[model samples]
Structure formats: structure tokens, C-alpha cells
Target: MIKNLVHHKDNIVTISETMNCLDAIEILEQHSLRNAPVVDATNTLYRGNIYRYHIYKYKFHHPDADLAQVKVTQFLKNTTRVVHENDSFYQLIFAIRDLPFIAVLDKENVFTGVIQHDVMINYLAQAWVADKSGYVLAIQTRGEKGELNKLARLVNRKADIQSAVTFEKTTYDTSTYLMVTLPEYLDVSSVRALVNDLTRRKYDVNVVTL
Candidate 1:
């Protein structure tokens, strides 16, 4: 799977307790961000998450009021939570819904880094592409060691098949399924004939396209 835990930069959205509602809005707009974390001036303690929706609601009702005059601490949700660097990807997905970020902290609660959603998405996509298409093959063999290697060597010798791979399925016992990419065109009957030959030799072979 994905190995880059610090795939996203650690500069999480943060604001000072002295910041007002207007200041929070400005930070969100400048970064194109929807939310930010409020922190103390010393940066030692997390305050809470400031959401765009709450700011808009406040502005609608108090049209003439000065947002800068209102302290962010007044609106703080007061439920600060964080995630560790060693947390799993599955845990991160759930944490993002409520936290939008997982503040990396030391044992003394010192901020070390941050993880964002965009970076996580990029890392996961790269991992999926690598796992799915790394191997290609075509063969007719029983589910046994050395059988796949023998088919690969045969295809490589003939120069007709460029690459080959085998997939195995086990219900009560294991069976081999083969897939191969070939350069020359072969008709359906010719393919069936090859499969029949493999069956005569006690191989359960299924041809799959790549």
C-alpha cells in the first residue's frame, strides 16, 4: 500500500486565539481552504476547528457588527483532537470528516507536522496504479511452483508472446489461470486447441486477455 505518511506538508491550517472572525475568513480565502485550526499564540495548545459555514451564519445575522471585534475564542468548538504519524490510512479517512487535519505532535504535545486530504489522495492513487498492472503473462499449467517460470521461458524463446502471468484460485484445491500478451494473431480455434492440449496433461487452464 501507500508508505508516505508525510506525503502532505505539515503546514496545517492554524490561527491564533487573538484572531477575530474577519481574520479567519481572510486566512481561508487566501489559502482556498474551507477550514482552519485555532491555536494559542505560543502554539502549544490547539483551540478548535473554524468552519466556513459558521462564519457565514454569523455574518448574516450581524450584518453591521464588526467581525474583527469578535474574538475567535468566543466561537471555538473547544473539542481539539489530533492524530499521530503512525496512524493507519483507514483511521485517517474517518478522522478527516471531523478534523480535516491530523496534527502531528510529540510526546510533550508539541506540533511537529500536519497531514492534509489532498496529499493523501495523491499517495493512494499512485499505490493503486503500481499494484494492479505490474505483471503480464499467458500460460497453460497446473497450480504448482516452477510451472509459471517454465511457461514464461517458453514464450520468451518463441518470440511470439511478449510476456505472461498466471493467476491461481483455490476453493478446496488450487487451479491455475493464465494470461499472456502475444504479438501474432491467433484464431479462437487455435487458442482452444492449445487449451485442450493442456487439459490432456491434467492442467486446468483458462485463457484470459491482458
Candidate 2:
């Protein structure tokens, strides 16, 4: 998961606070981005996020205003929407849901870059491993030790595993659920056998998607 979120240095985009609003707007349009991270004059310190719509509105309200002389530093917002480079993957998801992206900072709080919304969504889609050619099983279990190992051992002997993801079904509950994808080679008879085996072991198994 960290590999999906972090190590994205090649895809990050940013702007400098010293840049004029017109220049920033042009860059945003060129890249087709909604928002961008603003950095200090030296481009090392993170300032805040600048939105394309805000710049467009400013231009509309002040048509004769000198856009070249107007710095982006004066109109930046959500300066606190930032996460450290070492932050957990969950933190990145929580921070960027309501925004376009979150600024990434180093140990010294220096501006690095941003994890864009589209990039995160793409990573999550890959993680889910969506497919029409496979069976996805949702198994509900208590937070028990060795349960995963037992399930893996049982399932591996029967069918090829494609992808798996475990998540807490609810924040207030201690119950957890595991979603496993079986290869497309698995047929109805094999799926029924797998389900029966899990039921025999006193585990709740259900077919979620196929």
C-alpha cells in the first residue's frame, strides 16, 4: 500500500508562491488540474493549495487588475492539508477525500510534491483487483489469530488466488472481513466445494461478486 502512495515523485506537480496568479492559472490549465500545491519563493517550503476556479474568479472580478503583479501567496488556502512522506497509506486516503490532493512534506516540513486524487483512485482500483472473470468471496470473521493462515492454506489447495484485501467492516465493531478473489478457472462446482469447506470449518463465507 505504501508503494502505491509513496514513491510517486515522478508524478507530482506543484507551483511556487512567488509566481503570479496568471502564470499559475496557465500552468493549471496546461496540466488540466483543479488545484496545486504552492511553495515558498525558494520552492522548498510548502505554503498552501491554490485552486484554478479561484484564480479564474479573481480575473473575472478584476478584469483590469495587473495579474502579473498579483502573487499566488495572497490567495492560498487549506495550508494544513499535508502529510509527511512516511505517513501511513490510510492517512493519505483520509486527507485527500474532500480535496483534490494533499501536499507531501519531508522530515524538515519542506515541500516535496502532491499525491493527486486521480493517482490515489487508480491505486485503490488496482488494489481492489476488479474483474469480471473471477469470483470474489467475502469472509467475515472475528479478529482471531491464525484464521487467515488457515483460510489461505485451505483455499490455496483448491483454487488459484488472484487478489485479497482485508478491512474492518465497521469502526465501532471489532469484526473484520476478508475479500478474496479466486481465479477465473474456478467453476460453479469448485466454488460450491470451497463454500462447503469453509462452512464445515464454521467460517462464514459468501459470494460477493463473480
Candidate 3:
């Protein structure tokens, strides 16, 4: 699963531990990169992660210090952040949250590549099927057993489902929020009929328009 999301080793931009901050910064700037994986001399083992901002921050403090003498290791940020290839998608999301990227490794701890920040955004868009023209419904209902199945039963009678997701309104609250997308060709009459059915069953539903 994660193998599909990873940018393989050959596609990665990496920095060696022996490289000075000056050379590392040059590589980062050339690619307009903010983060890169740091590796050992052989480029096999993962050392840690470095960010362009940390180097700039260091320079601001040690104005007279020569960056060429400074190793990239001095600025490593996500040193302990890494994911094994078999890790769950849930683990990947939590580990990758808000970072430029996170390292991916194999069973033997060999560096594979990374899961980039932009890739996660695209995954979310795909989950919502954002590129397709469709009817979307924003629904709110009490958190209870079989809520989704009941809604599905109603919607199936009217149109085929394109995508669906459920989330709690708040951690401490009992309310549930759901988003469901339907086929684009389904007529408005069918859509309205589905909504009416849901409402008659006491579900709070809204037709979401983009």
C-alpha cells in the first residue's frame, strides 16, 4: 500500500553527512527544496533530515561562522521520524503531518524514499473524488449504530454512491458528520427525493454545492 505512495530512492534528493552546510544549501536552493534526507557515506543508511530554514537560522546567529565548515548533521530536524514500508496508512498520516516529507524504509531498515507533503494533499483530493462533477451531501446525525448503512440504503434506491466519509463533530460530542458524493448524471429530482427520504427518517442533510 505505502509502496505505491513512496517516491522510490532514485527519485529522491538527498544530502550526505560529510557535505558541508554550504554545499547542502546549494543543492537545496537549486531544487527549491526545503527538506531532504541525510544519509551516511554509502548512501544506504538513513542518518536524519535537514531543513533549509535551520541552516539560515544558524547563519543569522553565527554571522561570522563559515558555513563550509559546518556539517549538515548540525541542522538535522526529524532525526527520529521514519516509517517502515508495512506501516498502516494511519501511522503514515500521523508521522507525516505538516512536515515536508517523511522517510520510508524497508524490512531490513534500508532507505526506500519518502512520502512527500504534496502527495498527501493529492491523496485527500482523490478520496473526495474532487475532480469529478457530482452531487455532494453534507449530513449531520446522531452517532449511533448502523447510521451509515441506513443512509446507504436510502441513497442506493435513488442513485449510485461515488464516495463517502464519516467523522465526529467533535471529540467530546456525540454528533456525527458525513459527506457523500453521488453520480453526476443523477437528476435533481432524484437528488431531492433522496434528501426527502433521509429527512423523513430524521437525518439532517444539506446539498453541498461547489
Candidate 4:
């Protein structure tokens, strides 16, 4: 699923290593960005990133220093983490969690655009669970054989599923949860019946959406 979420290089804004700190700062301000990837003169190679705070710090400590003469690369940080374009959505989610933005690389390992933190949040907000026209059902079942099929059959009897995501919910490995999203057109009575049926079948069911 994540293989399709990558942004291409042409869409990313980057600075060149040859650009001075003043020009780099101007570019950042123009885009209303806190940091941007730095590249070579050809703008194809990934150097590192430069931060706005670092630029100001450099200038503040050296008030008489020529800002235009100082190269942007001097303040570059090597801690930038990049993700591959073909990486799964799950991988991208983990990559961007603690990062302001993550660099994306094409198959050739060329620097592409960045996946900002906000972009991921927006993506999640639009996920099936967040769909207003649907109900997100957090259905808990055991890891035993045919549990998923049983759950599916019960849900299928009442509503059309929009999306389904399953994950282990318990630490001791006693139960698993499936985040199943049912289409919005399904009436409350049908959902209530579905939950009743699931509970009758011994499934721990919870309506996660209002």
C-alpha cells in the first residue's frame, strides 16, 4: 500500500550546497519551511539538510561574519533519514513519525521529494476508518483458525465492507483486532444486529465510530 504513496523529486524544494546561508534562508522563508534538503550544484545529489534555527544561530554568534560568504553546507546535519520510493505505507508511517519531513529516494537512490509530517497525518485522516460515510468496527477475535472468515461472514451479511485492517492488539497474544470499515449507507439497525450477532458468536465487538 505504501509503494504508491511516494512523492517524486520534481515536486520537492531543495537548496544547493553552493548557495550561501542568506540565499538559503530566503528560499526557506519563501516556502514557509523550517528545513529543506541541500543538494549539489546540479541539484540531483542529496547533500544533507539545513535548519532555519541553525542559520540564525550561526549569524547570531558571528554578527560580523559575512552571511553571503558562508556556504549552507557548513550548517548541514547528517541525521536526516530517507525512505525509498517503493517502501510500503507502513514503513513510511514509521519513518515520518519523529521526523519533521523524510527524504524519499527513487529506485536509483536519487533524492526525490519529501514526505512531511502533516502529509502523513492528512493521509491517515482520509483512511477508510476516517471516512464519514462509514462505520469503523474494531472487532476482536482469537488467533484460532477460521476466526477471520467467521467474522467476515457475519459482517458481510449486513454491510458492504469498504476496508479492513488487522493487527495484533494484545501483548500476550490472546486476541487479534480487525479494524473493519463498513459503508455509510448501512442503517444503524443493521449494524446493531451485526454487533449482536458477533457478540452472540463470542466476538468482542466495539463500534469505534459514532
Give the top-scoring candidate (lDDT): 3
Ordered from best to worst TM-score, the candidate numbers read 3, 4, 2, 1
- Candidate 2 lDDT tens digits, 1-210: 343455343455678877998899899899998888887768788889899888889889999988888999878998988888888888888887888777788888877677777778877766666653478888887778998887888888888777887878677865687878887777888988998998898888879545
lDDT against the true structure, per candidate, is 0.63, 0.79, 0.86, 0.80
lDDT of 4 by residue, 101-136 (tens): 778777887776777777788787777556564588
Per-candidate TM-score against the hidden true structure: 0.54, 0.73, 0.92, 0.81
Q: Give the poorly placed runs of model 4, Cα more than 4 Å off.
A: 1-6, 57-66, 78-80, 121-132, 170-175
Clashing pairs in 4: 2-88, 2-89, 133-184
Q: Kindly provide the TM-score of model 2 when superposed on the true structure, using C-alpha atoms.
A: 0.73
Q: Which residue pairs collide, candidate 2?
A: none
Give the per-residue lDDT digits (tens) of candidate 1, residues 1-210: 222554332345687888988988899889988777777788767667677778888889989989889887777762456665566777667766645555555456665556666767766544433233322334545656777676666445533554444557768685556776644354555556655665676665555542
Q: How close to the true structure is residue 119 of candidate 4, measured as C-alpha lDDT? A: 74
Task: Report how far off residue 62 is in candidate 2 (Å).
Answer: 7.5
Winner on TM-score between 2 and 4 is 4
